[model samples]
Target: MQLNKQNLTAFAGKLPCPDYDRGHLQTGIVHIGVGGFHRSHQAYYVHQLLKDGTPEWGITGVGLREGDRAMAEVLQAQDGLYTLVNQRPNGTNSSEIIGSIRDYLLAPDNPDAVIQRMAHPKTKIVSLTITEGGYNLNAATEEFDLTNPDVQYEIAHPQEPRTVFGYLAAALRKRKAGGHPAFTVLSCDNIQHNGNVARRMLLAFARHQDPELAGWIEKEVTFPNSMVDRITPVTTPEVSEYLFREFELEDGWPVVCEPFIQWVVEDNFVNGRPPLETVGVQFVPDVSPYEKMKIRLLNAGHSVLGIPGALHGHPTIDACMRDKVFAGFMRAFMDQEVTPILDPVAGIDLEAYKDQLEARFANPNIRDGVGRICSESSAKLPKFLQPTLRENLRRGGEIHRATFILAAWCYYSDQRHNEKNEPLEILDERAAQLHRAAAGTTTDPISFLRQESIFGDLSEQPRFVEAYTEAVRLVYDRGDVRSLMADW
Candidate 1:
């Protein structure tokens, strides 16, 4: 049978779907960005409440961008019922039907509906999984871009909002005028200090509309920073086909992810929240230690190898992991460079965490695309890789390997052909500008580094300048990543 709420009992009897009654779920949370990550991670935990026969908190997912239209339709068709496949490297897999999302609002189609859903008293938390660049942060200053065109439009047209920032600020304003309590704003994106970043950007947008409302948000609303981990790839037709052929269940948009998942959140909320600790969530007084560990090791580790992996003509992270040189570079990059900067996380054995991360990256079943990791290199490198670069400079540490990462990305920007001389895709919005900056790499080695927004003061730092110059020279001379690794 096709996946939908109407088939709940019958499907559960035939397949391993949710065992609890579907009618008991009530919308207590409104999650923005109904992407693969949100479904596989946050919604999975909320769905667990139903499986445990305590279905109080269902989710109302809001689609804020153009890419979300198809997702909105799929969930709306299925009554928010979709399959989740947890594939492991050890060749074992399991499937479950997650039933936490009760409704969806494609904001572009119906803006008022999105605002009303968020403004509703029962929607205690508004969570977001929009990617790093979606926050509209200024690349150079790392501050909220108040002058962004969308933000500007929202400032003027408060009632008719466009961006997520606008919708959130407007909805909160409505709740305040109605004398309803403020709801907590939660960020589930992989950005560094995600909660604080959300609070900063949200208030900035709100202040533009009404300064009083912004101040109220600053004082009343709780933005809990969280660290969420799950290797969820974009759902391809292959996944849907697999489900239909294997299980005789045709889920329109099933999420395929690795078996592992983790969420570490701050215990700060204006209204009540789910008992997330019941599902292995670490609710801590401070999320910094945990956040730093994840941002550096996992996110940073991805950046450390992303471009080099792509340049090696590898399609997925598992392929990169299978290459001895790529695998060696990751281990050295993590253990020697990233581990030194990270503080001792509470209850975490850093060594074991590093080993587990390596295993997860090498998981062949997940098939996370290297091209996907290379997509927002401009935004990601600054947040994920540059911190390590900056810290290594501050502490007078070796920067040869980190310097190679920068060079690899610059080279990757100019590469439109594979080793076989066939056309290859460079999947970045900034591809044109980056290729322009990478013009004459051998003759003008520092041109790419001169991008102030990306490299900032690193161009002026003597230590990095010397290391980067050498690294770029070495990669260009050998013309192969394998040789570069061998020399290192």
Candidate 2:
């Protein structure tokens, strides 16, 4: 079946399909960033709600960047319908035609069209999955960087806004003037306290653009913190070909993910929300414990596990999990270095959670890109490792494994090439600067850790500095990633 609205009925019997009248779906969620993660997780959840007769929660997805045009076109052609393929390690696969997305608009094509969608009276929620860096925070200060070129341009030209925050502030202004209640701003990014980050940045942007609107937002809006998890790999052509060859499905952009999925949300939406709990979403009084646990444990654990594979030319995360040395080191490292600092999270067994992470990483059917974990190490290392580092330093915990990860990152940045001698695509804002610093300073690890943005003052501390220097020298000595776990 060529998966589009017309072919939907013919394909419905082949897979679990939306049972509701697709025409009856109302657009309530104006989601910004219709990426793989959002489609496989949030949109999938909304699809379940619609199937169970939940009203007015169908998503009107918005794409903000020029790169999103391709996705926008695909969703438009398919009538906001696509397939989600779950590939499990247990030798089982499942496919479903998801129809929760009611519409999509490319904001770069027409900014006002998206602003108007956000201002719509029926829109009760405006969500985002615009990645961690998209928040535009000053890495050190954690405040909205008003001086960013795009931020400056958007502030100057409010009507033709370029940034997400600019569009949001403008939309709220319009909605308030029209006597409409503010929509809940839900952030699905993997940022720590993502809701708080969104609220802070949006309010800051609005205060600079219009102080009155900022006040209105501070008094009227609700930004709920959430913890969302799913191992959705980036979409590739091979995925589509596999779907067609296996089941005669021709989905232009089918999202492929692991079978595991979870969402823990704070029940604090200003405008009413759908009964998400009906579909297994855990609505909690506080999401901090869950958020911290996941970010430090699973999210941070990704880099801890996958980066070594990346350095060694391993194609996928499963390869890293299958490697006996890498897998063993991670199991011991987490037990010793990562888990001790965590405060008790409600209803979570840390030991069992660690076990599940190992199992999830070993899911060979889910070919999650090693590059995905290694992609933004510059930004991610600070976010993921600093908490553990700081706590370990404070409480006299061992940081040997943590420091090795740092050295591994520094090594990867310098040796940003694979076994084939092709340049590895490094996706980081500080890539050139880090490489230049590390050009010949492998023995003197201080040159790399002197990057105050990444390492802060930890480079000056004797224990961490010694550990980092030893690890870097040992690994760089042999130029082998497997040497990371060796006693340096």
Task: State the lDDT of candidate 1 residue by residue for 1-488, as single tens digits.
Answer: 77887766666654577767677777789999888899999999888766776566789999988778999989999998889989889877788888889889899898999999899888899999888888898767877887788888888988889898888888899899999999999999988889999999888778778899999899889999899999898788988888777777889899999988999999999999999788788899999988888888898888776677777778888888888888888889888888888888879999999999999999988888887788878878888888887999999876778889998788777666554565557766677888888776778888888888778888899989888888888777766876687668
lDDT of 2 by residue, 215-331 (tens): 999999999999999999988898899779876888889998898999999999999998999999999988988888888878778888777777777788889888888888777
Candidate number with greatest lDDT: 2
Candidate 2, which segments miss by more than 4 Å at Cα? 419-422, 440-444, 486-488
Reference-based lDDT, residue 280, model 1: 84
